[model samples]
Target: MAVADTRHDDTVTCMAARLLRDAPEEFALLGTSMGGYVALEVIRQAPRRVRALALVSTSARADTPEQVASRDRQSRLVEAGEFDSLVDAAFRGLVAEQHEKDLALLDIWRAMARTVGAAGFLGQQRAVVGRADARELLSTITCPTVVIHGADDRLIPIEMGAECAAAIPGAEYVVIEDAGHFLFREQPKATASAVADFLGRVDTSH
Candidate 1:
């Protein structure tokens, strides 16, 4: 439940270091979206310390050139005080088209952006842009693992989740139907059920 500040750390490696400094010797890790990239770095840095890992709506690959360019553009916009527009743009991509009509959900995301503030968002964008390709580390993961993707996820495709599960030795995979990038928010029951089932099989007795 410890939430380390990732705003200042501009790379997954640095974020991983900060995580290890505060985390217990052994702990289960759960991450979604950008957090997923950070979680994979943690496993790479301290494989023996993680009891299990759960990745939701994320990918193990580095961003495509177009993606990086878009992120850079967004970063500039945020730095110039277009924070509200950045959040709005992100929200449009983070959910299924239908969820765009969900005013409550839209408001919640907007509030999150405001809470983090412009500086924090820019830092996060830098970290996200600087993240490395973690696909090679998947085969080295010995702990139990779970991968959850939304069937209608617009940000990261469902194929990315499948490939992540396939790379891991014995990773469990789940697809939340009718959900998008924010599957946990869009489909809580299914997301919680998948997490519960994964936890049931994890041995954190040590």
Candidate 2:
């Protein structure tokens, strides 16, 4: 059970490989956001080691030029000591338009940003912006793959998750309605239930 911060996929891949080398018999990957990108990379690097995979609020494509530019702008702002503004912008992009006015959601987003901090956020943005397309790799995934996305996600649309599911044969795709990019925070129970049910099916099969 490892949680990787937003860093180069190689770092996470190396860590996963090392863990598998030490304990090849027991290893699974579960990741969200940029971590989900790492999980996909790990599977590509060491498919035999990853018993199962769960990707939440993620995409199989590289960042678009516009997105990359946006991340760079945000990174520059963070470097300029405008952490609060960066956090605010991030929160605005993560939630739906309707939820933007919800004080509770805003607080939760702020808390999440505080935990990650400016440096962490920039680091993650860098990694995400530098990621490669994982579509080709998805076809080779042998283990049970679960993709969860919020129907109302403003960051990565639900169609992206559906595309991933379509590419990965037998993969399970779950979309939680009324939830935005931060599904775990906005709809924890539904997200948890979907994951549990997916893992349960995998457990039974294995």
Candidate 3:
């Protein structure tokens, strides 16, 4: 993915369509945080093409007013050349207590922020804040789905994963303890195992 903002594909639906225009006829989807939103949109757009889904530390609900305001404030700070506070705020809920002080992990996050820069951040903020509620999209998704969440995720909350699993028929749910919003990174082995198992069980013979 470009990793930059939607880059003119502002809406989730539009971005999903963009990916499908040249994507494989069928593929697995593993979405983390905002990516979960995009993946749901993709399912909505083309359920037939998605062989499986792995939703990680994300929600299907619309942004709360407080969340929108907070994102806007953070965007402003980025515009004003003050990104440290924003990063600090985001990082606090991103990892377990032990990994919070890990320089390597912190560096990876910092590098991503710097790579996206101010413009991409603003675009993403707009896309997220304006995104739709995907709760209703769950029932329509027929692909093999696994909902994974950090047991101690501060950003998306653990219950959100259960809610998604409950909404999506036949969706398996897993929790990674000692992880936070950045669960896949914090517990890569477990995360990969879950993903691999799900893919292996998929009925691709059709």
Q: Pick the candidate with the highest lDDT.
A: 1
lDDT of 3: 0.82
TM-score, candidate number 3: 0.91
Superposed Cα RMSD, model 2: 2.6
TM-score of 1: 0.96
Q: What lDDT would each prediction earn against the true structure? A: 0.89, 0.78, 0.82
TM-score of each: 0.96, 0.88, 0.91
When 2 and 3 are scored with TM-score, the better candidate is 3
**Residue ranges of candidate 2 with Cα displaced over 4 Å:** 5-25, 204-206
**Candidate 2's residue-wise lDDT over 20-99, tens digit each?**
55544646678787767778877877787777788899888888899889878888898999999878777877976677
Per-residue accuracy of model 3 over 20-69 as CA lDDT, tens digit each: 77567887778889888888988988899988888989999999999999
TM-score preference between candidates 1 and 3, better one: 1
Indicate the worst ten consecutive residues by lDDT in candidate 2: 4-13
